[model samples]
Target: MKTNFLAAAAASFVVAGASVASAQDADAPWEQSPFRCEPGETYVMNVMVSGVEYWFPVYEMFKQAAHQFGCEADYTGTPEYDVNKQIATFEQALAKQPAGILLHPMNPDPFVEPINRATEAGTAVVTFAADSPNSKRVSYVTSDNAREGRVAAQQVAEDMGGSGQYAVLENPGQDNHDRRVAAFIEEMEDNYPDMELVGRASTGQDPNKAYQAVLSLAQANPELGAVFMPEASSAMGAAQAAKEAGGDIRVMSVDVNASVLDMIQAGEMFGAINPNQGTQGYYGFLLLWLAKHPELIDPMNDHAEAGFNPMGIPVLDNGYSVVTQENAESFYWDKYLKKRGTRGIEG
Candidate 1:
């Protein structure tokens, strides 16, 4: 009886050992595990203005997701706002044949060919923040620009007692910015009957240009109660101009950085509409990974034969929130960086 019991115990141990070995083999970096990355398989997060603090949080989460899957991640982009320079940087990244790319195309049309080319070459490309709709990119992850603009309009109009003149500073030709501006105007015209759009200026995201534009708007429309823009890069100069012009203008925009949060906390500016940037980074990576491993999907459609990505998702809205004086502390970039214990995007 003792010998028989020992034999059964040894057999059970062997089965458990084999199970452990199989699991470890499945997770080996040298092998292509369904959910794990093979050795040297790297994914990249590419943006237009690499130094902008806005992209850092996004990259932080992107890097976190990559690490979870035993994959490598890198951040690359041009410091300048020039689309050509960004495209050049993108081409350089593409030349390496990286496993995947999460790109924020500075513009849509100009990126179509490049995005399509990358996908055609079997490298998965997923766009974030902005999109190249006419391209073969797998998907886009972003907040709804139209909804963000509408919310901004409502907040500004309510702050002005629902009857006032407002101006808009713009970055023309950028798809997301254009959508936000268009939606802001439409919301004002449709819902806030008492509010009037006094003027619009293309700031081109240059703070000095925004400064000049706000000053000109304040001078041209003496009753201007507020000024809105699609992004926060120009908000610093716009707020300064507003302060110079008696500080009553509600200077608001979308997205935020360290300075913007500080300005909000100090009441130097009204508020900001900020996107959920972490979601953009985290889910953006997932979409890119899934697109790269399309064989995991046995969908009804024959995406491979059709020369299309199997994910087939056009866009995703990550959602956003309003950043005001009461909650501005939670959005401070420095505080977040301290907690994260990493350089914004340098790592």
Candidate 2:
């Protein structure tokens, strides 16, 4: 179903007022759950990014969780968004053979065998951010990407009155981006038949390319009602292009960058989906660490009569948030910043 953006934005203040009047509870899960690790327990993490702001918070969260668990953590990744490079890093991580490895697989297929090899070699392995769904990885930590896409599409369709031309900004051929786009298109086709998806362009997570894509779409289809970007960098460019064009096109995207949050607060952006990057890193590592030490988790698994460690699940749903002006203040980065220090938010 579609949502009324104007109505939601307007009512947010009222809802905030009501919640404040009702209760002042401040207990969140992150604050309650203790970090699970032991002293001298060393871990290594490999991410997939080229120093983008999006991935840094995730790393920081992972580090913070590692600290809480009394484990040492290290993060390194490629300078560019290259699957081959990420694969090489994964191989290198296997070489160092730390207690466990947290990886964000670049592709869904090629990383499967290597991840299996890592797990078989007894190096507790888990996937984060993105996953190789077919691999033997212990846990897959990430926001529900498909659900995020479906939500974005539903919101866009509702905002546009369920009819009009729309476009998508994708991250080249990335599997995560592909999954999101596919879900969005499927949602539109199955539910909002009146909404036409006219264009799908790749921005490569570069602002200029994103700008060009949105600019081209707006120029080609002046009637374009909304645009959804699955990546944060491209979302920024889409907002700029939408602003420059001065059209009715509403913008929606994924992730929570400081600037993006500000834009959403100022009503410049329609809304943003926050996958809680910090939590992803924190929990991704926790699962891997726990998998390595079955003693700690065996009780819960055995009590529930569950199977052995790793769970062998196809995918793990980390979580996501639909951030708007009303709740932006509550979702601060202090916890992540405190652990990562200045370095945490910088990247």
lDDT of each structure?
Answer: 0.86, 0.74
What candidate 2 gets wrong by more than 4 Å, as runs, is 1-39, 295-314, 330-347
**Who wins the TM-score comparison?**
1
Checking candidate 1 for backbone clashes, the offending pairs are: none
Candidate 1 runs further than 4 Å off: 1-32
In terms of lDDT, which candidate is strongest?
Answer: 1
Q: Residue 63 of model 1: what lDDT? A: 91
Worst 10 residues of 1 by lDDT: 2-11
Which residue window of length 10 is worst by lDDT in model 2?
1-10
Compose the digit string of candidate 1's lDDT tens values, residues 1-347.
44234334333433464466568786554334456688888999998878888898899989988887788999999999999999999999999999999999999999999988998888899998888888889888888899999999999998888899999999888999999999999999999999999899998788999999999999999899999999989998899899999999999999998888889999999999999898779878877877788775576876668877666557767779999999999987778889989776767
TM-score for each of the candidates: 0.90, 0.79
* Candidate 2 lDDT score relative to the true structure: 0.74
